[model samples]
Target: MTPKEAIRLAINGRTDIGQVRDENEDHIGWYNHPSLPMGFVVIADGMGGYTGGSKASQIAVKCVTEHLETLPTSTFQACTPDQQLLVIHSKILDALNAANAGILDAKVSAPQLANMGSTIVLALVWQDKVTIAHLGDSRAYLWNKDGLCQLTSDHSLVQEMIDSGSLTVTQARSSRVRNHITRALGVTEFIEPNINTYALIQNSLLMLCSDGLTEYLDHGELEFVLSTHRPALECCYRFISEANEMGGKDNISVGIIEYTLENKVSVSQANISVPAPSSAPVEDVTVRKESRA
Candidate 1:
């Protein structure tokens, strides 16, 4: 009889105030134990150009991480794949909802903080799969030797226009209303996040970041740097530097979790068509969250 081995991860995260912002409104929550059955990395960007954006980001990260850790760790580590997904899926929603409630409640206690909100993105690694969820423009990306796949889409007015063919990617990048978002954590009574999961692919690197990083760099530029497959720390450093170099007009934040399975082959799945870099960004053909290895 053979025994199963635990999966390993190289996790790294960083947030910068950037050259333009006087305050670093971004907050990060990361549990980067090298060997763990489950863990997560979360990043929230304060609604830039608004009062209390920084404080709102702080509260959002704190609420989500604190609420998510309330899960049944022992059961999560030992449950069947189907059961694990159910547990984590429910937890992610609960945590996000708690974060929203926490922020709204804060507004009632302190009216000065009203209208403040933040964009959130989270990546949860449980067993051998990564489940992701987000609101607003914060993003999650999956990268390996094959290429980069953008997992989450932006929740912004400009993005809505882009989706409806009213604007192109290039125009959206240069739009004066680029930072305006349609959804956030503390602004309103209701907010729903987009969530998905994928089987853990060995040598796969998951990256999460604020719109600051995405602002200066697009998908093609990101894939170029990640293609090197450098250690998570170095890659993060480069990401920040590049963003700053390209007119770091806003706060820059990033989190990287590179996965590796010692002495084991990568998880195999059906019908993943990831293409090489081209004029257009890589297409997403990765497996879904419900599908386990």
Candidate 2:
């Protein structure tokens, strides 16, 4: 049986031009594979001038998805979680190199595509495990009983400053170089992706979004919506809408995945029967207490 008929998942994705741009260079997509505990979803935000940016993001998404599709199922089942993660780490670096080469070849004669690059954040749901591979500033968040936890650290200049103790979390948020990404696909032939694997629990929700969403919503807001919401699709839409309502200055894209005891959740049909968040805003900014390495 196909994944559609075997395991059930709810997915809703949207990309907006936002309040700042005439074109949307962000892309998000989910692919459900049959006969495996694997689900692939990716979100890419391109950075370049016009067509170059859009094309670079599209290429990154396509390359990663295609590479995953061609990978043997034995790869996932053949090793421990840590070993699998290492293999995935190697694959991401290899794929980024290939993508960079492709982008360079495409831009050899066209100056418009010369300096194009993209931030890639990929999530793989396999059985009870959530594997995340990320570069640039896009992020992954997990929502459970403990609330929302950021699964990846951004590869940006501000992040570097924070690491060096040159900037505080509050200062990094409003830093001039906050948007300046330090790592991305196609910018360099050698790229390193931070890879992690989490043991997912039943009735958990995983969210993947570009920086556009985080630019507005705080962790408390995310926890409220994700933990309280029943339908995954609505949560995804509300996220994008809220981002736009709060002055979306860049392209926005979001993808959601909800885990269950059995594959019973329907994608088109959502169970909209959950309690709402408290009528309060969570604007508290907490200090960073975790190390990136």
Each prediction's TM-score against the native? 0.87, 0.80
lDDT of each: 0.76, 0.71
lDDT of 2: 0.71
Clashing pairs in 1: 197-289
Q: Write the per-residue lDDT of candidate 2 for residues 1-293, one digit (tens) a residue.
A: 11323444555567777899888888877876655556767899998878888988888888777777654467566786556666665565565566656666666767768888899888877655666777799988777676677777788998778778899877876788889998787776556667666665445677899998988887778888887776666888888889999999988888887665466543321211212223221121121111111
Q: How accurate is candidate 1 locally (lDDT)?
A: 0.76
Q: CA lDDT of 31 in candidate 1?
A: 80
Compared with the true structure, what per-residue lDDT tens digits does model 1 show for residues 1-293? Answer: 01135466777889988988888989988886444555689999986345578878888899788867666477666786677678887888777777777777877887887777889999987656778888888988888777788877788889889878999999999999998888778776666677777766556788899998998898888888888746655788899999999889889899988777766555653222233324332223222222111
TM-score of 2: 0.80
Q: In model 2, which regions exceed 4 Å deviation?
A: 1-8, 72-90, 263-293
